[model samples]
Target: MDLDALVGRARSLAGGGATRTVLGLAGPPGAGKSTLAQTLTAALGDAAAYVPLDGFHLSNAQLDRLGLRSRKGSEPSFDVRGYEALLRRLVGEPAREAYVPDFDRSLDEPVAARHLVPAGARLLVTEGNYLACDLPGWREARGLMAEVWYVDAAADLRDARLMRRHTGFGRDEAAARAWIDGNDRPNAELVERSRDRCDLVVTSLAG
Candidate 1:
């Protein structure tokens, strides 16, 4: 996406007379959804706060109980209802100080109440793999956002990034490839299904 255009839109939504705006960035793993969302929030500074979907990931214990730890990145592994509820709080019934959880990649765990989005905040920037999906709860998310952007990148690029990310987080190359091939890629495909619903389709980053 053109940095100028994206920044312009963010500034307008943040500065305009609108009450509160929730912006969602959805895409496959390694599509730069998180990075773009962070940059956009930074552009808007205090007017924006981030809410990541990863923090809502079901704990390893819960996944183990369901026999789904192996498919940890899949849509079913998330707390869709919790995310929907938070979005509602962020937009429909915003408050003065809203606390949110953050995910620690190194620990593969969620740290609750790590961040706060103050009341009267202008923008709520949320990023995740399944925000725009046609699935039951995800449909509720699409309803919550004032705008959603789907980041699109090449499959090879995505794979490379995924592999690198896995390795960086302590996985061996083979294990990383296996995880990507067995788990993440399928999740990416499933997440991609919701792209058509995005208000904007971003193809590249702006300088």
Candidate 2:
């Protein structure tokens, strides 16, 4: 939880290589993966760029067609192949500018080109729920990262944060609880199983 120390570590990763290095943060939902990614990117400024896995969420139409609407945030609900391709491009073409996608909680959909990894960015910070997963496309994506960190937090705290997120995004309290119990909890359990695969385990991040 030492802010300055974490910043120094991230800076080292940024400068550690000739090609752009990628630092991945993997954790269950509501474990503050995005918060830590943003903190590092902000501290490093132009030297860092961010790409979030939420951007690869399947559209509602596609979810419905695939009969996965009820399990929207599950692993199979993401376009893992596209995410892997983007990461590959970032690692392979360090000199090129790459547009990144993001998920809009307000619209509950993925938006294209919401972020940019400009040429000369020495580090690319990407965060997601499945970076450490041993599955096919996820495994390929993980192989491209210089390091992967597992962010951890109390389950109760995560549940509270998730409830607020769901309600803030239009779900009623009751519906949010139901969805969390039915969908998010399972996803988190699956994600937690990959914790041992990460290079580091982050218990918390300094604000």
Best by lDDT: 2
Error of 2 at 178 (Å): 0.2
List the RMSD of every prediction in angstroms.
1.8, 1.4
Off by over 4 Å in 1: 15-18, 204-207
TM-score of every prediction relative to native: 0.94, 0.96
Mind giving the per-residue lDDT tens digits that candidate 1 earns over 39-145?
88888888888889888989889999999998987899999999899888777655567888878889887779987887767888999999999999999988988
Question: What lDDT does the true structure give each of the candidates?
Answer: 0.85, 0.92
In terms of TM-score, the best-performing candidate is 2
User: Distance (Å) between predicted and true CA of 51, model 1?
Assistant: 1.0
